[model samples]
Target: WFQQSESIIPNHLVSVPHPYVSIVKKCTPFPIEFVVRSYMTGSTSTSIWKNYQDGVRVYCGHTLPEGMKKNQKLASNIITPTTKEEDHDRPISAEDIIKEKWMTAEDWQV
Candidate 1:
């Protein structure tokens, strides 16, 4: 007989004991991550703020503010959903992401 090890468990895994596991429970794939940037200079904030001020709003299709400070907090932070690849982890505007089809128009509505 073999037993499963905790180290082999995936990070996203959530388990319930046999008696507690109910048939009514359902699992759904919610592929979404929300990222917010509040500080610039060495963070994602600078790039985002610069794009907004340059009239390049809408990264992928997300709208941003017209003008913002280097270290100023955003009126409302935005989200950038990226792929699982480490190289693909880069902050992008909603407009650019939407325009590139990385995100859908509906996704930007959030």
Candidate 2:
């Protein structure tokens, strides 16, 4: 269904045997997952509401202004990337990803 759409990127299937068995082309995945938040919520340390309550001026790579209320809409959308881990996903910054050589600037440019 998605292949019918020109705007959507489709995964290349390598092989298929039965309805339950199928193989797809392997692709290099970004080490971090980008999460965009519009409103403050959640209880984790990385959550905007919790971070704001704790007086965090900067979150991920976005600088949050002072005096923000819980569940309030942010001035703009914020992208918070989290590292995929076995147990817990940890919040990470774009700079950290570049500094740690997780992804190159050119790779992230697109």
Instruction: Quote each prediction's TM-score.
Output: 0.38, 0.73
The TM-score of candidate 1 is 0.38
RMSD of each: 9.6, 3.3
Q: What would the per-residue lDDT of candidate 1 be over residues 1-110, giving only the tens digit for each residue?
A: 01244365323335545654623335443334455655432334335555555565664346655555667775655555543334555544556567767668885564
What is candidate 1's CA lDDT for residue 92?
A: 49
User: TM-score of predicted model 2?
Assistant: 0.73
Predicted model with the maximum lDDT: 2
The digit string of per-residue lDDT tens for model 2 on 1-110 reads 32354245545566567767767778877768888999877798667778778887777877888877888888778888878777887677889878877789876665
List of clashing residue pairs for candidate 2 = none
